[model samples]
Target: MLHIWGRLSSINVRKVVWAAQEVGVAFERTDAGASFGVVNTPQYLQLNPNAMVPVLQDGALTLWESNTIVRYLCARYAPGRLYPEPLAERFNTERWMDWQQTALNPAGRHAFLQLIRTPVELRQPELIRQSNDETEHLLAILDAQLGQHAFVAGAQFSMADIPVACELHRWFGLPQARLPHRHIERWYQTLRERQASQGVLDLVLS
Candidate 1:
């Protein structure tokens, strides 16, 4: 059986869970980060030196990094379905995933931390403005891409949609201005309707 270690509240872990669901892989999850606290333990550290929330253990293989796990699982279990096959197509899909990690996540982090994690008394309004502005700009890029395709990769729901949608969910879930990005909202509504994203992507940001 495939085992994943991470707390359910984590967006990184949610990415893995959403991927597994899309690929239809049978996976077991163990809570192991934040308040759960198993990640920093000696045993967990041995499995993943980064002490990350999500660590995948499958037979003799141990893997960390949520994005890599999502890719690995989709490749192994879903292949042409979730994981695209053509060389150009695969790279194109992967680039969006990379963008989510590099561009989207970083911009959204401060806003998320300020709005949700930090108490109102301690929150920095300036930092939140900067983050929200950056995030909204990055999302406009996504909106343009989405306007061209139904999913991240053309019309199909591929591996790229998983991480990107997770990040978008974080940004959109917050109490904020109503974004005029029609394409993103449309795509997000489509994602929310899916069983794969139901529990993971639909959760309250924590």
Candidate 2:
């Protein structure tokens, strides 16, 4: 059986879990990181030297990095569908997935940290504003992209949608004012309707 290590509260872990669900994989998940505290253990270290959450172990192959884990699960279990079969299509999927990790997620992280994870008394307004500004601009770009297609990468839902949806899930949960992003909202509603997103997207932000 595939074994996953991380807490549900983690966005990274949630990505892996959601991908596994999308691919209809049977796996075991252990809670680690933050209050759970297994991430720093020597045993966990062998799986991920970065001492981060969301480590995937499949037989002798161990994987870290949430996006990579998502890609692997879909490519292995749902190829030609969630993983995409054509070379150009696969690269398109990869482009969006990479953008989520390297662009969208980072843009919104500080706001999430300040507004959700950090206590109100300790919050930094400037940092939150800066983060929000950066994130909003990116969200508009996503909205424009979604307006042209049914999903992030193409007409059907694929691995590309997972991380971007997770990023949106986190961003939308933040306590802040958001201008109505029609395309994003429409697309996100579709994602939420999927059975695979039940536990992963429905949960409240941490």
Candidate 3:
């Protein structure tokens, strides 16, 4: 059986867990990050030098990095389903994943930290405002893409949706100024209906 290390509340862990559910893989999870504390231990560090929340252990293979784990699971298990079959299609899916890492995540992290992680007394109003503005700017790009396609990769849902969808949960849950993208909201509503998405990505941001 596959062994996963991470706390259930972690978004990175949620990505891997969501992918596992989508691919129908049997796996066991052990809480390890934040309050769980297994991540800093010597044994866990040997498996993942970064001491990240999510580490995948299957047979002799060990993998870290949430997106990499998601890709590996999808390719090895569901191939051509969650993982795109064609080279061009696969790269296209990868593009959105990259976008999430480079663009959406930074914005989402800022907003999440300011809104949820930081207490009201200690929170910086300027940072919160900036984060909210940045989030809106990043979301506008997603809105445009979603307007044309039902999913990130055109019609069918793919591994591409996992990271972005997780971010979307935070974006929607936060008490922001306003969102101009109706299409993004509509797309998010669609994701909310998925069992795996609900089980993993749909959680209070912290």
Candidate 4:
């Protein structure tokens, strides 16, 4: 059986679980990392030397990095659909996935850390403000792109959407004022309505 090791509260872990659901795979998820505490164990360290929350085990294969795991699930199971078989379309999907990891996630991480994880007394306003500023600009760019297409890479939902939407779930769930991005809200609502998004998208951010 496919098994994922990480706490559900983690956005990265949520991506893998949601992808497994999207590809119609039966899998088990074990909580590890943060307060759950198994991530530092010798065995867990062997699986992911980075000591990150998300680690995927499928028979002999062990995978780290949430986006790579999502790509693997789609490529291994869903193929031309979620995996996007066409060369141009596949690269387009790959582009957005990398952007989410390198751009969007970094822009918003500090804000999420301050608002969601850190205590109010200890939260730094400047860090939150700066992170939010960068994230909103990126969100506007994403909004403009979504205005032209139904999904991030194209019209059909693909593996690309999983990581981006999970990041959105984190940013949007933050308790603060956000500028209106109508297209993002519209596309996100559509993603939330998908059956596979039930557990992943609906969870409260942590």
- CA lDDT, every prediction? 0.89, 0.94, 0.86, 0.95
Q: lDDT tens string, model 1, 63-166?
A: 99889999999899999988888999999999999999989999989988888999999999999899988988998888899999999878998999999999
How big is the positional error of residue 49 in model 3, measured in Å on the Cα after superposition? 0.8
Which has the better TM-score: candidate 3, or candidate 4? 4
Winner of 2 and 3 under lDDT: 2
Best by lDDT: 4
Worst 10 residues of 3 by lDDT: 197-206
Q: How far is candidate 3 from the true structure (C-alpha RMSD, Å)?
A: 1.2
After the best TM-score superposition of candidate 3, give how far the Cα of residue 40 lies from its true spot, in angstroms.
1.0
As for lDDT, the candidate ahead, 2 or 4, is: 4
Runs in model 4 deviating more than 4 A are none
Screening candidate 4 with a backbone cut-off below 3 angstroms (N, C-alpha, C), the clashing residue pairs are none
Give per-model TM-scores. 0.97, 0.98, 0.95, 0.98
Model 3 spans with C-alpha error above 4 angstroms: none
RMSD per prediction, one decimal? 0.9, 0.7, 1.2, 0.7
lDDT of 3 by residue, 1-206 (tens): 99999987788898888888888889999988998898888999999999887999988999999889989999999898889889999999999998887888887687788777788898888887888889789888888999999998789999999888987876777766676688888888888888777677567766
Candidate 4, position 21, lDDT: 97
lDDT (0-100) at residue 87 of candidate 2?
A: 96
